[model samples]
Target: MRARFIFSALATTLIGTAPALAQDDLSVDQVLGAWQKQKQIFHEAQSSGLGQTRGLKLIAVEGVDAAETAPQQGVSVTASTDAPTSTDTTPMDPNKPLVAATATTTTTTAPLVFGQLDPELQVNLQIKFGFDSAALADDQKPRLDKICQAMKLSDVQLFRIVGHTDTAGTDTYNERLSVLRAKEVARYLVEDCNITASRLETLGLGERFPLNQDDPRADENRRVEFQALS
Candidate 1:
C-alpha cells in the first residue's frame, strides 16, 4: 500500500507537468510500460512455383493493449516498472514442412483500416489547429513535446504517428487535413524533439475511426495518436 501510494503521487505529478494532454490519463512512465509490441514473423522458404511470393509471413502481431483480447503471443505490459516478459508461446507443429526460417520481424483484430493503427496508446488530446487549416498552435507544441519524451523513453525503437479528425468536413478534405496534421506532429517530433526521421512513420485516418462513436464530430475524435512498434 505504501509503495502504491508513492507511485500514484508520482504519477499525479507527472500528469500535472504535462502539456494540455493532461486531459488524458497518460503518464511518461505509463507510456514506457505499455509501449513495446511483440510479433512472431514466419519466413517461408522458396519453392519451385510462385507460392513464396510473399517473402515474410506475418503469423501474429500483438498490439500494445492486446494482452487481454490478443492471444498469449504478445509481450504483456502494465502501467508499472515491473513489465511482463514474453517468451516463444507458439510451438512449431510437427506436421508442417521444415523450412529454413530466417526469423525476420491494429486497433481491430483485422488491422487498422488502411494499414496498422493502435487506439489504445493514443493520447486523446484535441491538438487544436487553426480553423480548417493544418497549422498547429504554439501552445500545443509542448503537449506534443511531452509525447516525444514518452516515445523516446519507450522500449520500442520505431513509432507510428497517425492523424485523426472530427467528421465535420467532406471525406476528401478530412483525409487531406488528417495527413497534414499527422505530418505536422511528426515534424515536431523530428525537428524539435530530436527524434530520428527513419524511426518514425506517419498515417492519416481522416475521421474514419471515431473515438466517440455516438458523436463522430466530437473534439476527442480530432486527435493525434502515437503508437509504439516493434
Candidate 2:
C-alpha cells in the first residue's frame, strides 16, 4: 500500500509540471532561424523593384559591381548647308554664318540615401503590471512621465507601440494579451497625454523576443517599446 501511494504522488507531480517545463524550453537556434527568415523576406521584397510604383525606390538595387556607362559618351551631332556656288565658301565673315547649331545632353545617377531605421527615436517604455489605474508602480511614474514629456516636446508625427510577453501561456493567448496591453498604453498616451489618434500604430510580438531566454517567464522580458516618426 505504501509503495502504491508513493508511485501515485510521483506520477501526479510529473504530470502537473510537464507543461511548465515545455513552456520554458524554447531553443536559441529556433529563434534565430525565425529572425533570419523575416530578414530574407524583407530583403527580397525590397529588391523586387515594385516599390517604384509606390514612389519608394531602392537606391542601390544594382550593386556596386554593376558599372554604368555615361549616357553622352562618344555622342556627337553636326549640321551643314550647301555652299552658294562656291562663293559662300569664303569663311562667312567668321561670325556672320547663315547656319545656327546647338547640342543638348543629359545624365542621371541614383540618389545616395538608403532605407534605414531612425536612430534617435527608438525608445523602450516599460509597462509593468499593476492592479490599479496605473500600469507601473508609483515609484516608476516619474520616469515614465519624463519620457512622456520628452515625446511631447519633440516634433513627433507618428508613434508605433509594440508589445511583447514572457513565454508563459499558449501562443494565441499571449498574442492577444500583448496586443491588448499595447492598445491600453496607446489609449493612455492619446487621451491622458494628448497624443493624437492618427499618429499611433500598434503591434504585438508575443513571446518572440525574450530578454532572458534561459528564463522565459521573467517579467522583464514582457515589455512594450515606443518608436517615434518625425
Using alpha carbons, what is the TM-score of model 2? 0.44
Q: Each model's TM-score?
A: 0.56, 0.44
Q: Which candidate ranks first by TM-score, i.e. highest?
A: 1
Task: For candidate 1, write residues 105-176 as lDDT tens digits.
Answer: 223333221222233433445688776655556788877655778767765655656678989999767865
Report clashes for each candidate as comma-separated counts: 0, 0
**C-alpha lDDT values of all predictions:** 0.47, 0.40
Q: Report lDDT (Cα) of residue 190, candidate 1.
A: 70
Residue range with the least summed lDDT across 10 consecutive positions in model 2:
1-10
Model 2, range 117-166, lDDT digits (tens) per residue? Answer: 21121244556654212133345444345445645655445454556688
